[model samples]
Target: MASFLALLPRSLTTFLYAVAALLRFYGNIDTTPISKIPLTILQWSFITFILGTAALLANLGLEWNAGNRSRNREIEERNRADQERQRAVSRARIQNRFFLLQTRHQLTPSPETRTALADFLSFLQEYGE
Candidate 1:
């Protein structure tokens, strides 16, 4: 029952197409077969139209999904690049702080300044990883 309902729209569409084809091509005198089998122009048109429309729609869906996947991949790459830039900026700040501490220690020769420089260096190492 669920599956039948799922196919209801397609079945209804096919029925409507059949009705339209019958109305348009009713009382045709050319009943000649296009091939070995007895197939009229109206019948061929109906068959081709149905199959062609299905194929075209399927192709369009595939192309749409492919385009979305490509767009998502580009966004992910941009995010990664932004994160790398942020990390580079943070490392530069740490290096600057370490240099300032080193300069102060050189001038005053204090244990506190030395400890601070060591701490900044350790932080830079951790952040780089």
Candidate 2:
């Protein structure tokens, strides 16, 4: 109710102005040549056509803006999801490397492989895995 009342002043002002405009438009017309009802109808139709065009353009602008903003947000979300997937792959790679090093150490036991295992272990610890 409060919100409805807030619009009352502007609505009343617009209605009174429209009425005054219509009276002034019809006043100078020589109704002796044309009937009053048809002349009134034509003016009303013209006003409504102009208003409709304005509303259509306004809605089109709103829709275009919404689509552009939505596309940007969608791209951002796709990039964030792609980053998360890459992080998961990195963690898995670290785990797989640790597993392979352990299995090889149990088999051949080469010193070079031992050094590689130490380096790999350090990498794994720093990898946030």
Candidate 3:
């Protein structure tokens, strides 16, 4: 399919030449151009309309892509901020739990409370790193 598409232009050109030759054989086909043919108003208007439409579509596509990029960046930033807030909340909860355990241990000393405090400190050390 790719090779066929690549050869399409050459094939069309050869076909046009064959057609021109056949036409020339049937009549006295003048090859010389007497003057440059000026385009009619409608033809010029059609060309200008096509060019303007193409430019407008191209500009719209560019703007759409730019808007999508900015929107994606904003969404990513929002996601990152949400994740940070969650982490901060988790850290605060852990600290509050640790403080509560420490206060209980200070009021009434217990082996279980000491072990739990030690475990919490170890977890904080590992997580902070």
Instruction: Tell me the tens digit of each residue's lDDT in model 2 across 13-108.
Output: 455456556755775663332354555544554655565555556556666876999999999999999999999999999999999988866667
Q: Pick the candidate with the highest TM-score.
A: 1
Ranking by lDDT: 1, 2, 3
Q: Candidate 2, residue 15: CA error in Å?
A: 14
Q: Taking the tens digit of each residue's C-alpha lDDT, what string does model 3 give over 9-127?
A: 44554554454455445334443432475654344444445555555565566668769999999999999999999999999999999999978766575887678778889999999
lDDT of 1 at 88: 100
lDDT of 1: 0.73
Instruction: List residue ranges in candidate 2 displaced over 4 A.
Output: 1-41, 105-129
Error (Å) of candidate 3 at residue 18 is: 40
User: Per-residue lDDT of 1-129 in model 1, one digit per residue for the tens?
Assistant: 966754554665566566546634762756577679787766776675676567556556666876999999999999999999999999999999999997766768588767877898899999968
Q: Which lDDT value does model 3 have at 120?
A: 89
**Candidate 3 at 112: error in angstroms?**
14
Point to the candidate with the largest lDDT: 1
TM-score of every model versus the real structure: 0.55, 0.45, 0.53
The list of candidate 1 runs beyond 4 A from truth reads: 1-29, 32-39, 109-129
Worst 10 residues of 2 by lDDT: 30-39
